[model samples]
Target: MATLICEASGDWEKAKCVIKDCGSLKSVSDGSVSLDSSATTFGSTATVSCSVGYVPKAEKITCKESGVWEEAQCIIKDCGSLPSISDGSVRLDSTATTFGSTATVSCNIGYDPSVATIRCQASGAWDIAACTIKDCGTLPSISDGSMRLDSTTTTFGSTATVSCNIGYDPSVATIRCQASGAWDLAACTIKDCGTLPSISDGSVRLDSTTTTFGSTATVSCNVGYDPSVATIRCQASGAWDLAACTIKDCGTLPSISDGSVRLDSTTTTFGSTATVSCNVGYDPSVATIRCQASGAWDLAACTIKDCGTLPSISDGSMRLDSTTTTFGSTATVSYNVGYDPSVATIRCQASGAWDLAACTIKDCGTLPSISDGSVRLDSTTTTFGSTATVSCNVGYDPSVATIRCQASGAWDLAACTIKDCGTLPSISDGSVRLDSTTTTFGSTATVSCNVGYDPSVATIRCQASGAWDLAACTIKDCGTLPSISDGSMRLDSTTTTFGSTATVSCNVGYDPSVATIRCQASGAWDLAACTIKDCGTLPSISDGSVRLDSTTTTFGSTATVSCNVGYDPSVATIRCQASGAWD
Candidate 1:
């Protein structure tokens, strides 16, 4: 030992230089520290290391002369940074780059990662992970449509063009592959044009069962009709082109001789009818004709008319200039002996009818007027052979009973004359009064009796025989005078005629009511029966009482008076006199 111990104190001292040692190291956060050697002596070296997933700040620590190892610490490790993906991001367990750290790779939607997670290597480097774009499968087939891809690959953002097949519509023009690895919907629908317009009085025929675009249709007219258009087309816009069908027209109708036509409708189209009207003397062969499909009207005609024989007129006959009764014939009218013709001639008209002609009786002028008479006609009109009767008025006579009208329109001579009556006859004991100065038929004579006579008839009238009727007056005679109960009569005339009177005398003790009764023209005596005479009661005396000889104080009755105690009566007895006086 080339030790310097020989020079040191001779005691062979064992003192020697000791190596510096370092103490245990602190543990690392989220990791642990380790050493290559457990020695912590000065001048000795130890390797500094971290636990799993961790790393040391220094490689090794050596014991220094100061007995302190060099400053060294173990901390969490960090993977520097994960490798970036094309469309992804990375997340680490911690911000460490040393060992045991893991990084997770998250691919963006529609992308795929090479690995889900990567670890930091023990050498302080991170494992590699990557992201790649996802692939979407091929697009599905679209109904009623076809598809065309821009590229054969179907990745995100890839697009495909779409088109509808025949009779269909592609609602979408193109579809894209989405980030979710699916393609956009291809909305394809069947093409359609709604119902077509109907043809009026016509029909429409379609080429195909469907009314879709590109379909064709034919337009046709019904019987008796014509179409304006023959066909129509469906447009790409799912609509049909404008078209219409209309009716056919027939030309104007032909003219018929002696007749005219009238159309049933305003148009001369097929199925229309026209009525025929003939002229006055013409007859139509047919009533109506119809328009045909051949653009013309059916045949029609008119013919001359035939009129029947003329009718017979009462009391007259008709003579024809021509024997034929057809149109344009002429006739003449003739009447009987006393009749006349209204018209001389008549002609047949084109309407199968004859012009009017009449035979009428001859008319006579008014009859001559008479002084006081009138004439009565048997018929309303003064025609030929008519009769008229002449009548006299109240005071006149007719010269003729009946007269007739002559063929020369003259009436027979007839006259009305005043009636005549003979002189009025005298009436016995009576006078006559005439109504008028002249004594004509219907004259009146009124008769009146004398003082003592009565008229048998009061009036007389002149007769149609031209004579005055006879009248007589009779003497008014009264019957026997009425007898009174107790009286007698003395008549001046024995016959008791009108104006005669009788003297009425009461019987004994009775007095006549009237001195005389007269006979009146009414055949009755103007006298009442004789009544008995009555005397009233006697007057009272100054102081006496009276006594009656009979119960009644009538004619020939007596009365007696008695005086009062000191009274005296002028007379003691009294008698009622016939004159109703007291005696």
Candidate 2:
């Protein structure tokens, strides 16, 4: 009874029983594991196995009688050798090739790798067929230039050198083929003429300093100079056309009919002026001429002078001895109506103007005297077109203040009239009288009030509107009444008009010594007449007591009294009436 036990439990009876050779062995390719007969005993053998693509290791092991089992060693399936690439090479990850392992593929310096990495599969083969080469597209064309490549083929990582043709420049010097299968080429541009040509005694204006084909340049001459050629253009050969400038000059001056010219210098150059003048009795139509850069002189002429017609005299007639009133002619003047000329004749001069000193105005004597006014002349000697102002004496005014001296040797007095405010206006309750007999404009009248009246306005004047301003007379009234002690006054009327009276009365316990007052016409009031009166001692009472409301009992005062209790009395109160005795 040799019984086997579980390794986990040291006792044989406690271990779980397992049958020998009850399960099939794990399968392997190109290899095998050994077993004892059909039934396995306490000691059985197990061998590791492998196929052609996988490597085998760790040979035989015995199975235990317990449920515990031993492992057989068989490595991963091998992919054998790496596949060859056309323009690339493969690098294996490890010495032992197996599933889930990787190999990297690379190409030459100018070539691109189509597959960077290849993995091994469980079927014992690599995932990729082979590594391929990448080609970059053809290079792009460059204007005005050509390119030189390092290699003839357009492949990845290849460089091309770019060069411009003569008189041209390249935007970029070098380009390369990128890994993305595209070739880049540098651009080229044509060269430009640096700057425009400079000009002497002139200025050059160019459309652009880059003076490429079809560029234009304009030339302008300085002051006192002119350009031979006004414009020039830059040719395609990178040169500017020829242009020149010369000094400016003006030709001979033009001749004048009746005028002579005086030039600063004999030569007629630009900016020269010629002064022209006429003979003694003549005037020049144009005063000066100037030499211009256009080789021409400004136009000018001279003409003779003649006085036109003779002037006419106002308020008189004149006769000309000659038929035409030309230069050096005379005309005689005669009086018409009441007009007369200060000078006998007038002459026309050669200066195209008449001699006006002989055109004198007639004289008018002193202005006529106004009835109640005086005249002030603008000039002491009256002449034509002169004026005078008229004024009246005090209490008088003139209808017109201004008078004019006419050409007929007389003053115009038609509109002049003396204004009189007839007999100063009468006023009620007052008398008004003027200061002078002439009651015209600008006159004053004094006013006086009656016995019981007052002059509201003291003086009045005669105005220019022919009306008299009268003084106002109003009834006189007195102001507030005078004060009095221990008494009061009452006016007969609300207002203290002249001749109005006020009555005075003393208060209780006093008498009025003076009783009345009056308002006077002079706006003053009569003296207050309210003197106080004293009363003697009060009377005594019999069979009772007496009480006086005031200490002194005068007229119009009273006292209270009471008889002894139950005693009869003649009266309960005693009065100091106006009778000067107690009642």
Best-performing candidate as measured by lDDT: 1
For all predicted structures, in order, the TM-scores are 0.40, 0.33
What is the overall TM-score of model 1 with all chains considered together?
0.40
Q: Model 2, 414-518: lDDT tens per residue?
A: 334656677667788888987877787777888998898978777888787778885688898787887778788888788888888888887655566557788
lDDT of 1 by residue, 1-583 (tens): 3364554466674677765567775544544445566676666666665566556677776667887767767666555766666788888767665567677888887788898888887666778777777677877788877898988889988899998876677888888888878888877776677787777778788878978778888888877776777788787777776766555577787798888999977888877889998887788989989877776788888898887888677878788897798888888877777666777777788878877766666778676566677778877867777888888766566677888888888888876676688678877787888978878888898988887777777789988778888888788788877776787887886778878888887776676667888999788987666565677767776666788977988877889889988777777688887677777
Q: Which stretches of candidate 2 lie over 4 Å from their true place?
A: 1-259, 264-266, 269-277, 282-395, 399-402, 408-583
Q: In candidate 1, where is summed lDDT lowest over 10 consecutive residues?
A: 25-34
RMSD (Å) per prediction: 40.3, 22.2
> Residue 492 CA error for candidate 2 (Å)?
14
Residue 62, model 2: Cα distance from true site in angstroms = 67
